[model samples]
Target: MVVKNLIQHLAQLAALEISDSEVPKYQAQLTDIFEHMDQIKQLDLAAIAETFRTTEEENVLRDDIVTPSLSQAEALQNASLTHDGFFVVPSVMKDKDAT
Candidate 1:
């Protein structure tokens, strides 16, 4: 794609309002990025393994232990409206024709 169209597309994707004067700067930067990607694409790496990550890091998750929680009375203490043991909430969505 042409630099001008690419810049406009990038600006739209990024939700940016670019001035006419800034177009050249963005175009130059995008052109450089595309050039680098093209250079990488031209590389011969048939012997290399596909690497998802370069570091040996793992996510540490805590044990799912049961614990004491707030009672029904405590939970509904700050509620404006409550029926039985549940909090009452107003309807958030309305019919389109109601407008």
Candidate 2:
């Protein structure tokens, strides 16, 4: 539904053709939205704090402790170039000294 008539409706809602100058007017709507959000925040949330959505459970979180991974030699066995116990790649610095 949105993809259809999106081009036609945009000019009507925006009061101007979609172009570089027209973008800021749409972005300025955010200021009006933040003003409304400020009004909602002023209300006392101390007592009537219920779960905002139907779900009331804390997000079950996993422990952040480390998980084991493959050993360095095993991981680097297939690399194109490696030396001094580490993977190597092409140097990003331009070789300006080369003639």
Quote the lDDT for 13 in model 1. Answer: 79
Candidate 1 C-alpha error for residue 50, in Å: 2.3
How do the predictions measure up, each by TM-score?
0.55, 0.36
Q: Give the poorly placed runs of model 2, Cα more than 4 Å off.
A: 1-23, 49-68, 80-99
The stretch of ten residues in a row with the least summed lDDT in candidate 1 is 90-99
lDDT of 2 by residue, 1-99 (tens): 123244447665655457656556555665567778889999898998677877667767887889899899998999999998899999886554477
Q: How good is model 2 by TM-score?
A: 0.36
Model 2 clash pairs are none
lDDT of 1: 0.83
lDDT of 2 at 52: 80
